[model samples]
Target: MPYDPPPELAGLSLAQIAEQVAARNLPPLDTWDPPETEHSGMRITADGRWFHRDSPITRPAMVRAFASLLRREDDGRYFLVTPHHKQAIDVEDAAFIAVDCKADGDALAFRLNTDELVLAGPHNPLRAQGDADTPAIYLSVRHGCEARLDRSTWLQLADIALADGGDLSVGSQGATFALRPA
Candidate 1:
């Protein structure tokens, strides 16, 4: 089956987006602590492209499946883990990219390149770093993994912050996040 990306964020209500988020059933990567470790030779580029042994993994399903198994250790290394095996994968920047985002009520939702929905809140906090001249924003995905917001998505988020109060900040789930690092 072909992968169908979710509809535009602007068209969906917060409740609907939340429902979709709740419906997702990702692998329990945390519980699976495989004793054996190996190298997967897979790398996720800074631009969110997945490659294996210098070949692009073009299949969305395969990419999504691999993404679901991803786990980042405290030392900042990424691995695809199972109950019996753990394999390393290199990440140039973030593990995923926030391809799109939307602001609904007091919450913000982001859709990743892997078709994963992330609702920015206490658990999934947004962080902005770098200087005013070149700022980078990221959202926590899961298991110590983060997603870098794409250019367009960052612009959308900027617009939202401006419209809210022009303070270069946005509030979600009772937390206020500065769009740029202070």
Candidate 2:
């Protein structure tokens, strides 16, 4: 059988857990984060891995790769969430994967995979709404910097890019998403 902490500890103070862990008095399975702030969430795994939703969580002293889903609100603030970690990474630095527009008609029939980079110039409502204006940045393999990535990676990347001011057009043929610069 596995050992589980009491339910009360699920939302306990992060400071308390940290202090115990630092002092080596606790088993290091507890996690915490400040409340009322974006990315202020925490979780504890069955294996005793303490996770902080505000930042990347990995095995102690280990580097882990993470990805997230992004959505742009009408107010302009970007909303992002990830299963690996609740922390949000700036979209500007993140990469995106887009489908080939030339092959696909204007019906917004495209896909975004992970590990591919997506870049755009500035905001143009006309382009975002799929009017006469075209998005500053579309999907292309060249934009990926010659790196080959699986479909999953591209999708993950697209999820984050779209959350950060990225827009998608639903056309007769397919769907297309764009990442415009701030």
Q: Which stretches of candidate 2 lie over 4 Å from their true place?
A: 1-36, 39-68, 82-88, 93-95, 102-108, 115-135, 138-182
- lDDT per residue (tens digit) for residues 59-132 in model 1: 99999999999999999999998878999999999999999988888999999999888999899999998888
- Candidate lDDT scores, in order, read 0.92, 0.30
Alpha-carbon deviation at 10 in model 1, angstroms: 2.1
lDDT by residue (tens digit), candidate 2, 1-182: 33322223224344443343244321111232212135434432322233465354654322112222333233433333333333432333213334321111222222223312222212211122223343233333221211122344335444544544465322222233333333
| Cα displacement (Å) at residue 38, model 1 | 1.1
Error of 1 at 7 (Å): 2.4
Highest TM-score among the candidates is held by which one?
1
